[model samples]
Target: MRRIRVAAAQMGPIQKAETREQVVARMIALMDDAAGKGADFIVYPELALTTFFPRWYHADRAEADHWFEAQMPGPQTQPLFDRAREHGMAMSFGYAELTPDGHHFNTSILVDKSGAIIGKYRKIHLPGHDEYDEERAFQHLEKRYFEPGDLGFPVWRMLGGIFGMCICNDRRWPETYRVMGLQGVEMVVLGFNTPSVNSQKGEEGIEQRMFHHRLSLQAGAYQNATWVVAVAKAGSEDGHHLMGGTMIVDPDGFIVAQLGHEDDGVLVHDCDLDATRFGKETIFDFARHRRIAHYGLITGRVGAEPPPEE
Candidate 1:
């Protein structure tokens, strides 16, 4: 039995005024807690170091560049790597990436037990509009701030299991998992910063939003026959609330462990990678069940084309 003690570290909101140093301190605290709980693998939420700045719009996009990380383990984040190495823990987390070439992406990385980054994933399914819209209750300018990920869904072998990474909105799309699932990924780790209420429709409150959140993760895990660790950066970020529903879902889509609130906390669980074999070899065996011929429309078209109105 290949068992990985995983920790989902859910962080509270980081207000705009908080520095990366302050945030890293908080993350270290959570990491310490996970270590105490005997967790060798921990996951932190998306944009784990800063406020959800995309909620505000800027006439000059470059003004937001300060929020992007030019280097992964650059000064401020080095401590995280050091602590992971000290504890022999593998870690995954999300942040905004600014490449030296000037490309920006919503990115996540997988660090091995020795603190070496083994894999990186840029979020592909970027949600929200590029331009500021008067209709939105709040701005979500992800498209304006980041380029659609050029790197496709990729998987790696680690911790005696196949691992994959995705970020925030990428988790909402089935394609994100299937692509890695095709590679026989045994586990998928992700981080998200989701608003508690729908910016488009306030009536769609936390209940509905959380429902969709769990629905997406659960479906992705069960369908792919993989374990899923979803961490959230949630709470009132300068008055705008983010729903923190950090959880660990098993291969059967059951939530084995979940954070009870939107606060700085850790939920640790022992995930058996072998638990995935039954479903994968039987019901979800893509090699035997996937019919690609009929899926042309999935890749061939950008938008859904309705069959003749009949």
Candidate 2:
């Protein structure tokens, strides 16, 4: 049946004072928990190693750089790899990546059951502005700290299926899934760190934000005919409240498993990859139903003149 038992490893907030060791220990505990539940794979949230730091503006580059990791399996993160190896579990997680060239990006990586790195994806659609504005409740300076991802949407063949990865803000965009969908992706793993309140839309309610989050994930899963594992790092972190709505969506747009806690928890589901065949071969068979010629405007030109009236 090509079934995979997946776990949405939703994490509680990481306090600003917490060390990397403490965070990694929390992740390992979750890994062990998932393994005990017979989960073959686990998905962790964005910036899983530390607090969401973009909320505060940093004038010094070094101070900001401290939040990023220079290497994936560096000393601080090696234990995660070891835990995955010990459990023979495949996993995906997000982190702040600092390149040797002095560039930084919001990155996520996939690891095989053997704990070998499968592939990586840098977040393309970075949210928030680079400059801080005094009018907002809190700063969301993602653009200020990380460069736009250079790596395009890529998919990999692993665990008896095609897999793809995306980060927090990337999940809100349809193009993020469509690109991987074109590659015949069977599963998509995404992690997010979303605030309960929108600083830009101050009047927006939390219910609306949660709706949008689930709507995007369901839409992406159903439209692409792929299973989606979306995890969250939520709750109050350093007094800032974030949303917690971790879930696993089936190819039919149904949320099979979900988390209802604002604390560290794991939600496991046995997902049948074969279930995607029906949608892909019938309703969402892109190769048979897609018309690309008319889509030139999507990439060719922006704000082009409209067609003349009849």
Choose the strongest candidate by TM-score: 1
Candidate no. 1 TM-score: 0.98
Which lDDT tens digits does candidate 2 get at residues 1-310? 9999999999999999999999999999999999999999999999999999999897785688889999989998999999999999999999999999998999999999999998999989999988878888888999999888998999999889999999988888888899999999999999999999999788775799999999999999999999999999999999999999999999999999898998999999999999999999998999999999888877788567889999
**Backbone atom clashes (below 3 Å) for every candidate:** 0, 0
Query: Residue 75 in model 1: shift from native, Å?
Result: 0.9
The alpha-carbon deviation from the true structure for residue 22 of candidate 1, after best TM-score superposition, in angstroms, is: 0.6
Candidate with maximal lDDT = 1
**Candidate 2: 10-residue stretch with minimal lDDT:** 297-306
Cα TM-score of candidate 2 = 0.97
Q: Alpha carbon lDDT of residue 137, candidate 2? A: 82
Q: Give lDDT tens digits, candidate 1, residues 116-217.
A: 999999989989998999999999999999999998999999999999999999889999999999999999999999998888998999999999999999
